[model samples]
Structure formats: C-alpha cells, structure tokens
Target: MSVFAGRFDGRVAVVTGGASGLGRETARRIAAEGGAAVLWDIDPDWLEEARKDVGAAHAIAFDVRDNAAVSSAAAETVARFGRIDILVNSAGITGATAPVQDFPVDSWLQVFAVNTHGLFYCCRAVIPQMIAQGYGRIVNVASVAGKEGNPNACAYSASKAAVIGFTKSLGKELATSGVIANAVTPATFESPILQQLPQSQVDYMRSKIPMGRLGDVRETAAMVCFMASEECSFTTAATFDTSGGRTTF
Candidate 1:
C-alpha cells in the first residue's frame, strides 16, 4: 500500500545520529519497510530508547567523530546484519553562533569534527563494504544554510557546505559503481537543535523561510528514506533540497 512498500526488504541500513530527530524517524521508516537497521549515536540512554521504539534494530553507542570507533561500529553492524545497503550520515552539531572574527576556535573545531570529519569517517568505513558488495546508497544530511550562509552561524554553515562539496566529489567517484551518494539540504526543522537557540534567533530563522514554517522531522525523513531505497537507482551525486522554498536556486 505504501509507495515504498517492500522496497528495502532484507536490506541493512546504518543511521548515524539515530537516537533523535531526522535520524530516528528515518530509521523507523526503514525498519517499517522491513530493513534491518543499525542505529549509531553517542547518547546511550536515548539510543536504547530509540532501539526499543524501532523494535528489532541494533543500537550501538559510538561517536561518529571517532574514526576508530566508527570503523569498529561498522564492522559490528556488518557482523550483525550481514551487509549494509544504506548508510545515512545524520549526526551533526550546530556550533556556536557568532561573527567569524569572534567565533571561538574550540566551537569551530567541534563543528567541523562532528559535521565534516565524522561524515568522512563514516563514509570511509562504509564505502569499502559497499564496493565489495557492488551496491549501496549513501545519504548525507546537509542544510540549506550550506547553500546560503546564515549570519552568526559561520561554523555550522561552513561545515554543512563542506558536506555538500564532499558529497559531490564522492558521488562522482562512485558514479560508475552501483553505489549512489547524495546529500539532502533541509532548512530549519522541528528538532532539538532549535531548543539551543535564542527565541530571537529561532524567530529570525522561521521568518527567512518563504513557507513561514519549520520543516517536520518526518517529512525530512521521508525524503531520506526514498533516497536510501532500492528505487533510487539513477539519482546519484545530487543534492536534494527540503528547505520550505527558502532555497530558490
């Protein structure tokens, strides 16, 4: 009955940041469609909760920024699920908002660590497996901010922009292979990250979107699910936008 009905039957999916927000929603959709899922997150408490909610998916407490830990997690996932058909790099941090000159070095580094380095680590860990199997779908979660830089959020914007470029390069590299790599740029979504911002900042974000609203996590997850499905055969090296008309280009 679902448009994606049985599209992922018997496949295995690994979702970083699967404990919350878009990642959690995406994992649930994958599981509902009959794929075995591996949920990776740094928060063990929330990870367990999500595991129970998803019902039968594997949950692992591993920081995506830690390359060695990510590699080990990938191995464990393959051991448990046999093969990883879909990899969603959804773990990220919205670092401090400030002018570039006033931005703290620590905050900048942390943003890059989680948003950029962590994504690369996961890709490195998973690409070999995908290559060996000659099949895989990779969906990296970027942001509309990456396309048009947001004032006072230099680090977050830069990191996400880097993800877009990284996705493009990697997608081209794996174009000939059966594997597909793409990134999604979603605007302000109803997620925990909004809680960290001041009311004024949040209001400003919402006002910028022509749709006059924040995106729902489920909507973003739906797009991700489609990209990760076997039905997504010909669309690689693309950046899908779910920015509520905030991005006209």
Candidate 2:
C-alpha cells in the first residue's frame, strides 16, 4: 500500500511463488494498486489462501520445475489477461544447509532443479510472450548469498548466482525489444523460506547484516513493485540490493 493506488492501473502482473512469503507480498501490492495479479504456486492449499489474500486475477498450482507446466501456465495467463506486462520470478528453495564437501548430491540436484532450471523454464516460457507483446518487465529474485557465498549453503548460493547471470544475459538480449529483465539480491528475511534453514545459520546471516535485522517482506516487496513498474526504465541486467546495507556493490 506504500505505492499510490492506480499507479499500476490497467496493468497485469504474474508472480511465481505468489502463494506465500515475498512473492505473496509482491502479488498483493500489484492487486492493491489497481492492477491484476496472477499468482502461481505449487501448493494448492496456499494457492487457495493467496487467491483470497490478493483477490488474485488467477491462481494456478503447478511446479515451476516442470517445463510443460511453466509453458502451459504462461500461455494460460496470456489467454486469461490478454497480455502480461509484468513477470516476477520469486519461487525458490534454500536447500538443506551443509558444507560443499558433505552436501548431499540429491539435495544439490533438487536445489538446482527448482532454483536454476525452474527459473530458466519460467523465463523461457514467458519471454516469448513478452517479446510478442512488445513490452514487459521481468524481475528475478536472487539472494545476497549469491553474491557472497554463505557457509554451508553451496547449492543455494550457486543456484542464485546462476539466476543473476541468467538475468544479465536475458536483459541484454531484450535491451532493444521494449522488454527489460533484472535480478534482485536480497538479504535474509523473515519468511517461510527461513524455516528451511538452520537456526544457527539464520543467526549468522542476521549478524552479518550491518542493520542487525532480517529484512521484512514488505520492504522487499516495495523494491520489487518498483522494479516491475514503468518507473524502472533504463535499468536492466542489473542487481538491486534489498540487503539492508549488507551489499553496497
């Protein structure tokens, strides 16, 4: 609600992982601002809740890891909304914490499957539609861990790092296409994702932040909404920090 109502009037946005956490906040913001938000999540129960929470334009339960699902969902969204002006890739998983040498191979693969490959699939599916429409904004959620590797989070770090690189390349490719792509690197936040990490690791992350506090999803959502808005013109293939001064570069 920080953004003025009608700022995004007549717009349509797609938020992956919009069932909960940062994604949910972003979706809710878009809807509150007179825009339509399409929420995509893998959990049907949460999807139902999110639909109510955001008055979602559309809610679909499908794993982002499934290439076919992402493709079909993109097509369905375009059909439902007529055009999608914003895309927020907010779905991700922080794999079980462990040192690189001891990180279970299965866990590593699963992390990449969702974090790296899944994002790739979503972007691949949606970019064509955006290109066709001749106007779009894409915001990929990455992490500070991607920039400064956190101890015992090898897979999560690597996956997000890939997201950063992917966004940069995609942004360049669409530079002149009236479509822009960028990635946001956020510090630790109080969200469902934190439940997946070890308490000690969480404390460690918090201590590292100069602000000595975890970020709030509301705060992250503020930055995300701006990035997805027309006000973000001239910024693409860049990394934005919602890291509480943890990242200055």
- What tens-digit string does per-residue lDDT give for candidate 1 at 1-249? 356767779999999999988899899888888888789999999999998897537999988888999999999999887898999999998888778999999999999999999999999999999999999999999999899988989999999999999999999999988999999999999998777677777788899899999999989999999899877889998999998999986
Clashing pairs in 2: none
Give candidate 1 misplaced runs (Cα > 4 Å).
1-3
lDDT of prediction 2: 0.92
Estimate every model's Cα lDDT from 0 to 1: 0.91, 0.92
**TM-score of predicted structure 2:** 0.98
| RMSD (Cα, Å) of model 2 | 0.9
Q: Give me candidate 1's TM-score against the actual structure.
A: 0.97
Estimated TM-score per prediction? 0.97, 0.98
For all the candidates, what are their Cα RMSDs to the real structure? 1.1, 0.9
How do the residues 127-146 of candidate 2 rate in per-residue lDDT, one tens digit apiece?
88889989899999999999
Q: After superposition, how far is residue 136 of candidate 1 from its true place, in Å?
A: 0.2
Cα-based lDDT at residue 156, candidate 1: 93
